[model samples]
Structure formats: C-alpha cells, structure tokens
Target chain A: MDNEVLNTEPQPTEEVRVVMPLVDILDGDDGVTIYFEVPGANSKTVDIEVKNRIMTISAASSLRRDGLPVVFKRNFRLSDGADIENITAKTQDGVLTLNIPKSERAKVHKIQVQ
Target chain B: MNMLARIRNAEELLPSTLGGLHELFRSMLDQVTDLGPEWLPEGSAAGRALTVETSEKEVTVKLPLPGCESKNIDVEVIGDQLTIHAARTEVKDENDKRHYIRRERSFMDYQESVLLPVKVRGHEAKASYVDGILTVTLPRENPGSPDSHVVKVD
Candidate 1:
C-alpha cells in the first residue's frame, strides 16, 4: 500500500511590481493638470517625486487578499515650460491630482490694439 | 475668405490626421496584448477595479471610486453574489474650451458583481466608503464550516 500527503501550506514568493496606474494629462492656458487612478492606495502610502524634468509616482496598496501587496507605479517626462518649483499635489479617494503651474514667460498676455 | 480656406484645409487634413490616430490606437492594442491578462481590467466592468477577500467570520469586498458622491453609489447582495453600481458626472467649465495637452479624467459609470466563496448572511452586510475605497463586509452564516478538508480513499 502507498499513500501520499499533500502540502496544504502556501509558498511565500517575492513581491510582484508589474502593474502601472493609468494617468491623464490636461494642458491648460497657464499650467498643466494631471490625474491618476490608483486604487487601494491612500495618502499615507502614495509617493510623488519630481526631479530634473522627470516625475515618478509610486504607491503601495493597503488592501490585499493574497500574495505580496499590490504596488502601482508610473513615470512621466515633463517639458521645459513647466515650473516644477510651484507644483502641488493632492490625493483623495484613490485619485491623485497634480497641478504644475507655468513660468511667467509661458503665460499668455493680451496686447493693446494700435 | 481666409476662414473658409482654413475650414477647407482642415477637411482635407482629416483623413491623414485620423489615419495617424488609427495607427497609434492599433499599436496601443498590440502593447496591451503583449502584456497579457494580468494588465487587463478585472470583473465584468470595463475599467472598474475590484477586490474580494474571504476570512473565517466574514467576507470583504473593496473597490476604488474617486470623486464619486455617496448618493450615486449602490450596493446589493443577491443570492451568493454581490453587485455594486456607481455613477459620477464630472462638472466642466462651459465657456472655457481649453486645449487639452493630456486628458485622463471623465464621467464614470460602472456596475460589477463578485461571487462569494462561501455562504454568508447577505442581509447583515455593511458597506462604507472612505478616501475613495468602498468596503463591504458580510458575516458568514456558518462559521464552523471547514474551508478545507482531507478525505481518505478506500
């Protein structure tokens, strides 16, 4: 007689960081507005960084059913017109919004008619 | 006269411009197909994302819905399944026809259903939305039921 036992325990694996968040960029007259849909992430877990004309968004999800926690990430290359120093970001309800204002020279100005 | 000429010019430009867009769209589809099923959206909803978790005493469901008001969201538990429906209309400026350099946000309407792993008390389910995450918790009807078991062959 031959009998076999089954391994019921789950094997631990390394964290998978493959998924990227979807984003939308809106170019306005004076600045640019960007929106990102990053579900399962909150303000505390999300990270936004901008340096040398590059912007990176990374976040770790708080909710999980199995395996390693879900991680969302994306990168963007900014144009020279953006004033990176005055950029502002806000996150609410799994959506992140970033406002990048334009420099003085980039703003539109009306000229007087002769 | 120049305005009419510009309009005619735009009409002439349509096919080539749209052809470029069609090529771009096809390339995007190829990229998505290359990434495989893991990159595709989950559940029946086209773009909505959802998660389901099972525990000893309860089962939980979560979804992300940003800019959605509480009044627009609907939750229903029918038989061994859970359904969530939501709609959010984005308000936009009527006069400002700002040229969009990059646009991603829009009004969203979604309906998704998830099957429960085990029998649960659907009537006693509770749901809450916090920071854009909607969480629904339902208590299992029979807590003592074994989730896994081993049988011996005769």
Candidate 2:
C-alpha cells in the first residue's frame, strides 16, 4: 500500500468564531435593572437614546497600544410597553448599571370599598 | 495427531494474571503525581464580584463601581437596549509640590450594555446615578393583550 494514499483521509475544518455580548438583568418590585460588562468605555464614547418607545445603547472604546480586538457587540430588544420615562443608568469600573422603574398603572394597587 | 493437538490447546487456554495491571498502575501513578496547591483549591473566590438579576416584567442591573463620580458617567436607552458609559481623565498637577511614592490608579474609561427582558417604552424609562454606582430602571410591557375584542351576545 502506498503510504501517501493511506494517509489521505479528509480532515475536518476548524469551527467559526462567534461573539456574544455579556449582559445580566435583575427584576425588582418597582422595576428591573440591567448590568453590562464593557471595558475601556467612557461617557463621551457612549450614547443612549430612546425613540418611539425603543431604547438603544451604543458605545465605542479606544484602541489599545497592543491592538487587541474587541470581543463582542450585543443588543437587546425589550417589550413595547416598558416605561422608559423614569429610566436611570450609570457606568463605573467597566460595569454598566441600569434601573428601570415600573409605571404607576402597572403597579398593583388595592381597591377600597366606598 | 491433529485432533489431540487441538484438544490440548483448548484445555490450556486461560486468563493472564498481569493483563490490564500495567494500565491501572499507570493511571494511579499519574493521578498521585499531578496533585498540587493550585489543583487542590478551585472556585475559592467565585462569588466575590457583583451579581446581576433580570426578569420578564423588568430589568434590574447592579455593579460594584467604586471611586467614580456621577458627573463622569452617562446613561442612555435606545429601543430595548440600555447602555451606561463613564469616563475619568485625571491630569497630574506638577506645579503643586507633592511627594508621591506610588500612583496605582490610571485614567479609566468604562462602558457596559444590558439587554432588557421585555420591550421598554423609551419614553417611560428612568435613570439615576448616585455615589459610584449607576442604576437604570426599565418597566415591563402591558399585561393586557394588544389584540382584544369584546363579543356581543346574540
């Protein structure tokens, strides 16, 4: 048997890279909070805007000296009726925190007999 | 002659005593040799960092942001996505006479993103910054179904 022919079996190709953004969400009585791990981002480079009941957050970080590539870009789509009027947010230590307050009508209220 | 040889060969067929003993010994030896301090302790500081929780009704995010100011931070929500961005630029004052042994903290710029569980009405979202921590509140969608019709009794 020819050595080359015997070793000519097909080899599998390497898998493709997939980047997924890291995010965490917390639920509270008043509203929900969201946390994101974004390193090397600043207030000026970040933009958060709400239009027609949709909230979008975008940020870009400066390149490092070593030219390390960014890991992933993530976007979240929330329900339509979410109250964005009273939304609050902050970023520090590479962590992004968001607090979303529930609307008054959404909150459960007890009814009293007249 | 052939029949006798065949019968004798069948009677002598028996299990070998040392079979598989070498492999078992090798495995045990490998395990004993690979034990060390790093291998012994795992997940020692697993839960020391900040924790985040989210649900369908609302999205709540918490982070441990120390030594940061609210003025240096910016929060925005577009569609269902919530973003928080903070930047701190510290310029060393050389004019003032000061003795410094070590300066550890450098200029830091941080940004993060969170995905809402439900569609957040951007107009109704609220945001607040306090101390070093930033919190964003996104309300849940209306519980009542959008597509509802009242039926009249015939």
How big is the positional error of residue B132 in model 1, measured in Å on the Cα after superposition? 2.2
Location of the lowest summed lDDT over 10 successive residues in candidate 2 chain A: A10-19
Tens-digit lDDT track of model 1 for B7-100:
2233356687586764444322211111112223331132235777788899888887766777889999998889999887653466655444
Best-performing candidate as measured by TM-score = 1
- Give me the chain B TM-score of candidate 1: 0.62
Tell me the docking grade of candidate 1. Answer: incorrect
lDDT digits (tens) for residues A61-108 of candidate 1: 664434456666655544455677888888877677778787666666
Q: Which candidate's lDDT is highest?
A: 1
Candidate 1 Cα outliers beyond 4 Å, as residue runs: A1-13, A16-18, B1-48, B91-96, B104-107, B147-154
How much is the lDDT of residue A42 in candidate 2? Answer: 50
- All candidates' lDDT scores? 0.62, 0.44
Error of 1 at A28 (Å): 1.4
**Candidate 2 - CAPRI tier?**
incorrect
